[model samples]
Target: MAFSLFILFLIIGVIEIYAFQAVKTFTKVKWVRLCYVIISLMSIVFIVYQFTRFDRSVGQTPMFMITVGLMLLVLIPKLLITSVLILEDGLRLIVGSRNYFNNYDKEASFLPERRRFISKVALGIAAVPFLSLIYGMTVGKYNYKVLRHTLFFDDLPDAFDGFKITQISDIHSGSFDNPEKISYAVDLINEQESDLLLFTGDIVNTNATEMHPWIDTFKKIKNHEFGKYSILGNHDYGEYVEWKSEELKNKNFEDIKDLHRQIDFKLLLNENTKLKKGNDEIALVGVENWGVKFKKVGDLNKASENLKKEDFKILMSHDPSHWDAEINTHEKDFHLTLSGHTHGFQFGIEIPGVIKWSPVEYVYKQWAGLYVNMERYLYVNRGFGFHAYPGRVGIMPEITVLELKKRKKVV
Candidate 1:
């Protein structure tokens, strides 16, 4: 552990040195240079101190969120600067070697001095993400976007045609700091007026108490005609934190489930409910968190129960990995599955139709947006709330609206 930390700090020191050189090369002002060094040192010290003081028993406090945001805000730009400087140094090394071997300019120094233009370009390039991170913390986190998709399924019940479902997932209420922003989001959800509302989980970061203050605010999400339903995400189990006792952990888990009720949402645990319209009905099956890398408690068999393969089914699973691992290949043939555990890694570039990319994509095949295979569909909500990083980048918080339509058969 000591050696690992030593290596980590050593690398950080090297990055800081190169980053500082860029600033120094860009300007000769003494105080400006001193200020840069002071700020960098202070940020490193504060980040290290806060990390050391972290208590596993009390996970994801507001202070921790702020520290994470600060660390990213300070470190990312510096890393970009350091990368440019390193590349420049590599070029300088090659050129200097060639010059020495050929005896060109004997009076010249072994290596050329760092270029101001390069420093300027590095700083310019670094500014984009630096400002973006700032915007993500202040504005992007609350920039809720309502994405609408119309899915046509031949198996869809005639009565359920044109049925709309609104989905919000990965609430992570414990990480919330702004009530006004959250209230706005709730209003946005209400504005949709979808027939049904579904929450895909992560209602709290770890402890249920994180949602206490926001209960009433979320309850404002006026009930839907078909109903409001939810399923647990991995974090809802309270497994990320160290509990005083098993009883306490269990209590927290129970309270997390109750949070769904407080918000007037029916919490589903390996259960299924049928939503009927006219004489036809569709099964809404929900299961607990099931992920390739996290907790695995969801039981599709139990959730399906008496439902048959012919029944048009909509599944609620917190992690999209469940669809890849089991749901897609199952004989039951779920028509639609909703999920939101990836949160698009809370960072990535996404341009509708043109391109969609995120680091999380490398980990989960269906990290965000809609995916279809063998006629079954899965829509992964980016997230309704922010976590660990305390903000979002290119991928904004989402409220997914899906409309069901029966596909027209051709002769």
Candidate 2:
């Protein structure tokens, strides 16, 4: 690990040097150049210092999130500049070799000076991500977008033909720095006034206490007519942090589960409830966090033990991967499954209908939005909050409103 880190820093140093050269080539002002170097060095030192102080027992603190954000903010732009400079250098090397071998510029200089135009272009390119990251931190994280989808399912109960369900996931409350934004989001959720509200989890980063401050802020979410329900996400297990003892870890898990109740959301734990509407009903089955790579505590069979395969069912599993792995192909048919663990990687290009893409897609087939297999459907909420880098890019936080329509049989 130490050797790997050493190499990583060595590469960063080289990239920084190349990036500095681009700046130097672009400007002759000494103060501007010196200021850039000083800021870069200070940022690197601060990030390293904060990382060194990170404790396994107290994982993902606000300071640690700042360090990660700062590191990415500084490093990504430099990487872009360095890549452009390296490409220019490669072309220069080929040209210089040809000139030296042919003795073409004997009186003139050995190699031509670096072009100012190239430096200008590199700077322009680097500015894109730099500004985007800044905007992501400041505004994009709180940019809540309500995505609406109408899914038609032949198995949907007639009573729920026009049922509207709102979903938000991956709160990661520990990362929230603004209360007003959260309150506004709750209001936005209330504005929907859906028949039901469901939360697919990651309520806090790691510790249960991370959500303490925002309990009341989230409690503002109004009750839905059909009811409000939630299921745990992988992070809710408190597995990312190192607890002093197993008992403490268990206690934290218990507390995390109670958070849903405090917010008026009935916490579902490998259980199924029947949402009755008049004479008909639909099975709302919720299992614990089940993922392809993360925790696998969810018991689908046990959760749906009382329900038959013919029943109209809506499964709430945190990770979308569970749908790709088991739910879609399970013995019991799940008409609709709701999930939100991917968070669209919190970075992606999503231009609805025209284009939808994210880095997380390579890992999760149903990373975001709706997906269908056979007759079953899964809707993956982008997320409600930020984590790790403490910002979002193209993939804004989401409040999903879905309307279920029963497909009529063709004559």
Candidate 3:
């Protein structure tokens, strides 16, 4: 780990130096150039200092947030500049070689100074991402968007033809920096006036204590007509932290479970419950944290134990990967499954039908939004809170409102 970090720092140092040189050439003021260099170096030093002092058990702190902010500010612009420069260099190599071969002068210099226009253009392009990321950190993180969808299922019970479900996921409460902002989000959910509420995992970052500060605010979530339910996410297990003893870890886990109850959420741990509307009923199954590479304690079969094959079922699993690996292929078809572990990578371009792209797509097949296959559906919420970065970019926090409809048969 030490060696890897050293190499990473070395690479970043090289990129910073290159970017600094470009800035020096562009700026006429000596003091401004010197200030830029100082800020660049200080930001890198602060990041290394913070990482060295970090303790996983304690989770995020104000110092960590500052370090992350500084790191992104410096790295995002530099990375963009580097990409532009590399492209220009590649073009330079081709043009330079062509000139040399055409002239046939063995003594003539092959390399020429880069055009000032090229430097200007590179920096100009870099500014876009630089400013955008800064805006994301300052404002986009707290910007909660409520995404609504109407899903029609042939198996949906007639009584639940128009049932509304407000789904929020990955509320990494530890990363919230503003209480008022969080309260606003809770109020937003209430505004939807959805019949049911569901949260799919990651209620806290590392420990149960993270939710302590936000309990009062979250407890304000408007009571749904039916009820509120939640399932465990990978981070809720407290496995990422280093505990002093097994007993302490177990206690922490229990405390996390209780936090849900305090907030009026019925915690589901590999279990199923019946949501009835008059004489008709649907099965709402919730499993523990289960992922392809994460903790796999979730048992779909056990959760679906007493349910009949024809019953309308909704499964709440933390990671979207679970649907592909287990739920979709299960003998019993789950009409709908909700997840939110990816957080939409917290950064991406999502312009509705035009384009939906995020780096996380390479990692998780079902990163965000809705997916359908063979009469089964999965809705991956974009998360209701931030995590490690303390901010969001193109992918803002989400409050998913889904209405269940029973498809009418043609005469």
Best by TM-score: 1
lDDT (0-100) at residue 179 of candidate 3? 88
| Highest lDDT against the true fold, candidate | 1
Candidate 2, residues 52-86, lDDT tens digits: the string is 89999999988888888888889889999999998
What TM-score quantifies how close candidate 2 is to the native fold? Answer: 0.98
- In model 2, where do residues sit more than 4 Å from their true spots? 107-110
What's each prediction's TM-score?
0.99, 0.98, 0.95
Task: Assess the local accuracy of residue 252 in candidate 1 as a C-alpha lDDT between 0 and 100.
Answer: 91
Runs in model 3 deviating more than 4 A are 1-6, 94-110
Better of 1 and 3 by TM-score: 1
Put down candidate 1 lDDT per residue, 1-411, tens digits, no spaces. 999989998999898999999999999999999998899889889999999999999998988999999999998999999999999999999999999999999899989999999999999999998999999999989899999999999878899889999999999998888899999999999999899999999999999999999999999999899999999999999888899999999999999999999999999999999999999999999999999998789999999999999998999999999998999888898999999999999898988878888889899999999999988899999999999898899999999999999998998
CA RMSD of each candidate after superposition: 0.9, 1.2, 1.8
Rank all candidate structures by their TM-score, best first, as comma-separated numbers: 1, 2, 3
Which 10 consecutive residues of model 1 have the lowest summed lDDT?
350-359
Instruction: Quote the lDDT for 14 in model 3.
Output: 74
lDDT by residue for model 3 (1-411), tens: 999979987988778766875686677799998898888777777888899899976867767877787778778888877777777778878877988888866586675656667778778987887787788888999999999999998878889999999999999988888888988899999999998999999998888998999999989997898899999999998888788999999998999999999999999999999998999998999999889989799999898998878888999999999988999888888999999999998989989889999999999999999999987899999999887776788999999999999899989
C-alpha-based local distance difference test score of model 2: 0.91
Off by over 4 Å in 1: none
